[model samples]
Target: MPSKRVRYPFQVLALCLSAWGLAWAGPPAEKDKAPDAASIRRGKYLATIGVCEACHTPPAVPAVPGGGDPDRERLFRMDPDWVRYLDPQRQLAGGVPFILRLSGTTHGLVVTPNLTPDVETGLGSWTEDEIVEVLRTARRKDGRVLFTFPPHSFYNHMALEDARSLARYLKSLPPIRNPIQPRTLPFEPQPMVADGPARAPQGRTRERATYLMGALVGCRECHSHHENGTLVEFAGGSPSDPFQGSFRLGPDLPLRQLEKGFAAFPYPGFAVLYGSNLTVLGHGGALERVPTERIVRAIRQGIDVREDEYGRPRPIAHVMMWQFYKDMADVDALALADYLKTLTPVANPVGVRLKLFGTDWEAAFQQTYGEPPTPEDRAAFGMP
Candidate 1:
């Protein structure tokens, strides 16, 4: 008390400054500030692996008329330029048409919504919390449920922090004023796929890989069992054999395939490709003989480094969505490779490992889906 009575004004001022510094350096300081560069950077990475642009971004050229699957040839073509087909200026300005079907019956065209931050046309009015909620619950603020195409069931399993990061990144984007058409569903919506498992905790590399494969990257969707286009079961030793891969029917030519069943008739040539068995359990499972480096190559470069009958690696079909996965960070891709090697290798072979090995797929594509996108079209999308 005697010492305080003798304290100078400068000492009191110094004590106040010290207390202010401690408060400013605490956790709340970081939390209260706007989304920093690191968080935005993280969000960009999450968006890349999640393939948000695949659905949300429209094509550079107008889709072939007749309102059906736009890039039907994409199912078979292994062109590395597939990524350039999307309109760059309109990135995430959703208008991509996804034809959702059930038991071969066409429900309707679901034009993806614009994800930009435009106040009038995009998610500008949506708060960060609202965007995070959509990622968690797959339902819009208006209480409308989402379709299965975006594969919300898988995305809903994303970690909370990751989802928040995604929202922040999206909100930070330069707003684009692209108004999307409402989804045109001819039939009542039906539940096509079941929800994925709960979020895997953040820690080990394998756990991160698990979430990437099962949730964010959605490896289990096409890789899982599907009789036609309809998903039969999700995972866990069911006769369906999760991650065992599925038989993918080819393009919806003349838009008739959607009206009819996906399995009503076989696609021309090797169009009826099989989703390779990603598990190591099955005897003829595709990845069983493939090395980890090859898997990483396939994921990052869209080239299946697995040896063919002639012992040469080939390009993966464009339908595999490697163009999107190609953007994944090395650490994430490596983690996925490590985790896949640890699966309970299931021996469920779906189709021939090298269906396109001997076929003239380019000529077939020209005959079926018309000449591939021209260079002018590619340039429009900002591809060299």
Candidate 2:
């Protein structure tokens, strides 16, 4: 027999490597389970991270019990008591409107749709698999491609089980009869990606990120500015790429402003609000230079990101949806960061910090919100 060190250690090392290799070998394909309580629970969690309520929820509704099924008659009557609950049981019944913009020009206005099981106004007519297919393709029940939903991309990349969970949860909701206004599209609906919805290859470093961030997490949607229905820029690329001017920041932005972590995003209700330029060419230096722990906080909490010259904390823009993403798995967030690092840089420098609000971002956030998350408060939020 070989020496003990050579025999035992090498054998163990080989075994460990084999196990590690299989981790990224891609998920074993399988059929999904039937919808159940457990699925609803999982879907509820994923939907929260997906920020379903952010777009789907209307501005306000009365807080009341979700008594009786909110069927067609209840919706028609518009009963206050039938509508409200803490978990937004009245949610996904879509009536929220969003202002679509590209380079300060009005693209169109679209309304959120009711996702309830209402026979007339909601998904009651749809089959579960149909919903999943629509989600995966960005094509609606009628084959129309949904253009503006950033989370749609994220949802499309979810595993079958997770995607099913979300669908099951939506079906579990009380189907209220809220007929939402349809989207006003400039072009006919089509698949989001060039080659259509293809799953990532079995094993590759960027495969998951390419699938998730490109379409799933909606990173590409926020970071790149497109022209004539094509993505022409990537926000995280090097500064010298030819596609620099293709961002939504418009071609008029100054380079210096980008250095200060400013970029423009024309929000639905607000004027063009600025966001961070997430490129290696120039960054807030918060994500690039900070420790991994702080980076996680920035992505999860959105606080302690910016600082005044005195190193005091400043506020980040709410446009990026850090609140909804706070629940993202630490692993996923890290994977996103790592994949982002591998992207080719674009020279698109973007900024107009707080132009829409006519106030400092920090002051606005401070006035409206409480403190950033602390590790001590983890238990309350379910962290270990």
Candidate 3:
């Protein structure tokens, strides 16, 4: 019966302090050092594969058409033009503002967050392990996981080597001292379901190509935009926004305007065309139409369908695919050609509803097809 007065709270406090002290003693010994130049270069390459700049960089305006600005202070700022059209007050992005458009409609704009290593506002304090954990796990502050990293899924099907390299590269970038506000989703955060372990596909060339296309190059992300202009999945239904469709690259430009010794060309001057369905119905369709040999020739030779001044298929712009594909040893271009042929056309109509009007279609259906029983009907049955 020594000191029967409640010592429970004090005991709890002491335990908490003891735990804190242990944690503060410093992280368990591990070799955490700055990555080497080769690792950094690998990281840079992986970052390109993920097309990290696309979201991190602000939308390109007429003043800055290509959207390549590296200035951190202005990075990831919501496009002013888009803000004017959507929210006049422009409340989000300065802080965690409620995003009304995302939930109210099928399509909505999501302000991308800044990833620069700014101490006050950016990820400057994040350790390499923390960064790796974020990409690998997709966890929120409360320890809930996210379904997808909307717009661009860098972690979606991401290879471990590539993820690590990208993380290292991000850490190495010169810290841009900009404090971007956090992103706000329309709905309350839903806990993320953990997908299975990442599997690197077999076949070196196929694996590398898939990594480039899926994680790094991000062909699917660019081609797929939700009706609200967000790039959620490879659903490929994003509307024509500011940068939705500005450049076209292929064998289909007016010949006279084409540059010397080139068949395929990049048409940046054309009216902004919404991204064509990359499925079997669109450009992927064209690729399927040709033989693997022709496909290889088209990429490596850059030959336009039309002839050059020398009466040969003029070499078009150097397709980077040719260079990348050349290094691929597996399946050759035929396998890629075959794979491109397999892309299914998205059956959903494009531009059916760019903006939602908020009508309750379900209620309308019930009224027309199955009306609720009237009070008289219930009374006749002696029902309460």
TM-score of each: 0.66, 0.58, 0.47
Query: For residues 1-384, what per-residue lDDT tens digits would candidate 2 score against the true structure?
Result: 111100000000000011111121123221244446665665676676566765565423222323335453233123212112213545667665443322112244456677788989888887666666666666777777776345564455556555655677788778888777676644554564333243333233466556556544555554554344455444532222212221222111111111111112222222233334455422443245655455556667766455767887765544455666677765566666666555455544443443333334332222212233234322221223
Per-residue error for 218 in candidate 1, Å, reads: 1.1
Model 2 C-alpha lDDT versus the unseen true structure: 0.45
What is the lDDT for 280 in model 3? 38
Clashing pairs in 1: 280-345, 281-345, 281-346, 281-347, 282-346, 282-347
Tens digits of per-residue lDDT, candidate 1, 106-146, equal 23445578889998889998887778767777667666766
Best by lDDT: 1
- C-alpha RMSD of each candidate structure in angstroms: 17.1, 17.6, 18.9
Ranking by lDDT: 1, 2, 3
Reference-based lDDT, residue 62, model 3:
18
Candidates' lDDT values, in order? 0.52, 0.45, 0.36
Candidate order by TM-score, highest to lowest? 1, 2, 3
lDDT of 1: 0.52
